[model samples]
Target: EHGRGPCDCAEFLVTLVERLTQRIERHWNGIDDLADDLEEAVLDEAGPEVGATLVDLRRQAIILRRYLQPQRDALRALQTGQPAWLESDDQRHLAEELDALERVVEDADAMRERMALVRDELNGQASERLNRNMYLLSILSAVFLPLGFLTGLFGINVAGLPGTGEPLAFWIFVGALVIVAALQLAVLRRMRWI
Candidate 1:
């Protein structure tokens, strides 16, 4: 009851808007830091935690946009409507706050885009790593399959297996196995599988 007028109320609202703008600026800075963290995590080939962090960053950006978009629209409407109670000075102050809000919104949008790019890069790196590991496993399996078959065959209790009784037979079989391995390696190298 201090006899405040309509202009006083408008001034108070402007002050509140200014404070909100300042807070949003701080929020935008926090988002910037998060984005930097995400980039570093990607470069370091961070694990699932990076994905979770990216999700959190995106969620924060979405929430910020959710609140900001409407506030921006209202400010625009106020500026365009120019109510009789809002003095010219109040309108100017609101315009400045609106500009600040717009810049923060743009920064948030850019940060989101950057996060998306980092996520794609992380996925690509993971997929490439998986493919390389699978290729190595396949090569190992290829190299070992014949060796396993030879060992199993020689271990069988069948009679009349060639060179079974000779004193050099074991060494000869070993030599044969080494030859087979060399041949397989040659073929694999020719095919560029290694």
Candidate 2:
């Protein structure tokens, strides 16, 4: 029903667009990865850590885009030539909101780009860490393999060293092994290999 007195047109339009923008911001500010079963399955396939962040961003983006369609349409309707959805005074409030929505869309795009860069950066760091671990393992194996063979061959009772036939021979080999291991550890420490 039409009101008898003039409605506070300015305040109503201001409140309307503000509420809409707020709703849009609540869901659109980030990427929107919805938490539906499908999204969860996708996240599971994506891997937990990076996948969660990406999914959230994706979800936010999707929600924002969905809200944005109507807002954009509203703006197009309010544009100078058309002026259909709203009158001239209402257009003032809507045009400002349209500008804000454009900025939001631009910011969302930037966020997507930033998340992509972060994923690439994290992947590179992970690879580098893996390689470093492999290199350390290789170094340790190289240092210990000969020592292991030497100790294995000499520990047998076939021949005579200082106490090969004695019960104390086992203790002597243990002591030698401890000494060799300690030397290896010292070298690794000095080289900062560990």
Candidate 3:
């Protein structure tokens, strides 16, 4: 039955802190779900959407941190009863609210760090996949380069190609081409390039 005084102030602070706590917990849960999705996508070799989601989560954490920090300070001030409007019981409730606010702040920082880690992991995975694709492409190009050159040289129209005059020259040319391809394969296998 204490009119608009310390008890009222304390109750208001408690309600505010409780609401803030619930909101922060909800946001934290959302971040956790996003992180789970990101981890799965990274493992599956999925595209960059996971990175975007992580960026969003980081942004959320940053905004929450900025908002929570001052609120936490204010709650701590209330706990100290600088205005002398808080009774002992009011101070206790204010202390509990301050603690909750501190927790929210910590959770915001932790979520931000987690988002950064996930972003880095996604970047590393993307880079690794790109490197692997490039490596495979380079190997294919290397294997085909000689074959392309040989075919280009022989396919050119000429007055006197060495193998053009004989009936069995076509078969012989094909056999030579097969041999060249086999040699390339064997060398690639030996070098562990394939």
Candidate 4:
């Protein structure tokens, strides 16, 4: 036995990387839930970082994937009697965990997809509301169009007009406008178009 702590051997980096990979597997699964929550803002804690948290989860998942390759290879080498001491059961557990973490990757993918869909839906709803508001405003403006046209045409004509030559012209003109307005309202009501 070289007796310098098995990892202190020439394969230290390889061993360390492998061990890190196993640990990474554990946290990988946690990332999945984090991503789901981030995407849905399912929990309020995610706050403004919801998107950023999902992005981070994806980034971590990718990193974990890269580590898993070398980790599995290292484990295989150990299994083939390459390591000075390979605890099969522990390694098996680590491998199982690694396998489980793969699901996390899949879940994160699903989460991002759902989040994108939700964002699009929210945008569509907002756009629809905006369009409806614009339409109503335009309709109201259209309804007032006649008033504007009537005021502009008769307002600037102070001379040579039917009402400009008579003493009771102003009263008669007002009376005529009231009758016209009443008739317009009655017609609108009859047509159920008011």
Candidate 5:
């Protein structure tokens, strides 16, 4: 609203700044709550949902920072009476609002850093779990490799296959397979491969 006099203009600007400060603080409080929850989710549990939440929070913080920085600079200019219209007392009130705006900007920046740290930690946990699963799979494959080759070799048809003609050949081969398995287990144990 355009004011009729300098006094009216000062009052108008001060009221406007106070309202803006309140709105920014409300949004900042919401961000603070989310940051607290995100921190807890990152620290206490695997929090499968936290990754998505973090992404959303980071995006919001970035957007807030982008928008708030310019507004804060404008407020600073108003506080210094860059337009030569604000009285000294009005400038002082604007300075208080500017401080609040600056605080909101800093809080947004801090929130972004916090979300990034949580994201990095979650990624590290996922990588560790993946590595563990891969290691277990490798161990199982190692244990089965030789046994498969032995069985495959015996199954091959040949003119002089040792176990093909005898009645006890099946039992003998079974026993030999058990021995091979035991030997493999022993070697794996010795080498700490198990």
Candidate 6:
């Protein structure tokens, strides 16, 4: 009804590219926010969920870049090729769109890199925590190993265990175990393992 012709195609394309660029910019901002959250989550030890969110964000960034690159390239070509149908004004508008697209693509790439760094930091923290936990467990096992052995030796129902006949043997054995634990702790402290 408006009697628009093929010459208007350039205007339509420009508008479409502008809308797409805006959407991509919004996505970039969201990814930026997520990156910030990931850093905070890492510091708080927020666990596997943060990792999953990072993975999703990385995937989104990759997909955005993947799509945006071709659009940017097409826009560049459209501006340079200058099809006979496109007026100088159309070419100018397309050039502006191309610039916007290029910026958004760069933003996507930068966001991906930022997410990668966050992932590495998260992995480092998790590894450190695991190592610390293992160290504590090893120390506990060392302290208990001798105590366990003593109990096992006395528990055997074989011939005359000297403590078996004495009413105070159990108390003595308990005291002995406590002393052993205390000694182990002292040794650990001296070695600075604690």
Per-prediction backbone clash count: 0, 10, 0, 0, 0, 0
**What residue runs in model 2 are displaced by over 4 Å at the alpha carbon?**
1-19, 29-50, 66-74, 77-80, 84-86, 128-136, 139-143, 155-163
**Backbone clashes in model 3, listed as residue pairs:** none
lDDT string, candidate 1, 1-194, tens digits: 67753447789889889999998998789888989988998999888889989988988888898889999999999999999989999999999999999988888788789889998998999999999999999988888899989989998999999888899999999998899888998999999998
Q: In model 6, what is the error at residue 162, expressed in angstroms?
A: 2.1
Clashes of 6: 0
| Residue 134, candidate 1: C-alpha displacement in angstroms | 0.6
Candidate ranking (lDDT, best to worst): 1, 6, 5, 3, 2, 4
lDDT of 2 at 131: 100
TM-score-better candidate, 4 vs 5: 5
Q: Could you tell me which 10 consecutive residues in candidate 6 have the lowest summed lDDT? A: 1-10
lDDT of 3 by residue, 1-194 (tens): 75754347656766666777778778767876776777677778777676677788788878978988888888776656556665676677667767777776787888878777777777788788899999999888877888889888889998788878899987888788788888998998899888
lDDT of 1 at 14: 96
Clashes of 5: 0
**What does candidate 4 score on TM?**
0.53
What is the Å distance of residue 112 in model 2 from its true position? 0.8
Which runs of model 4 end up more than 4 angstroms from their true locations? 1-87, 165-194
TM-score, one value per model: 0.89, 0.62, 0.85, 0.53, 0.84, 0.90
Candidate 6 C-alpha error for residue 58, in Å: 0.8
Candidate 1 has a TM-score of 0.89
The sequence of per-residue lDDT tens digits that candidate 4 reaches over residues 1-194 is 77765453434544564566556656755766565565456333334445565456557656665655665555556545535543554456545545544444455456556656645544565577789899777655655566667767778857776677779977887676677667766766687755
Lowest summed lDDT over 10 consecutive residues: which window, candidate 5? 1-10
Ranking by TM-score: 6, 1, 3, 5, 2, 4
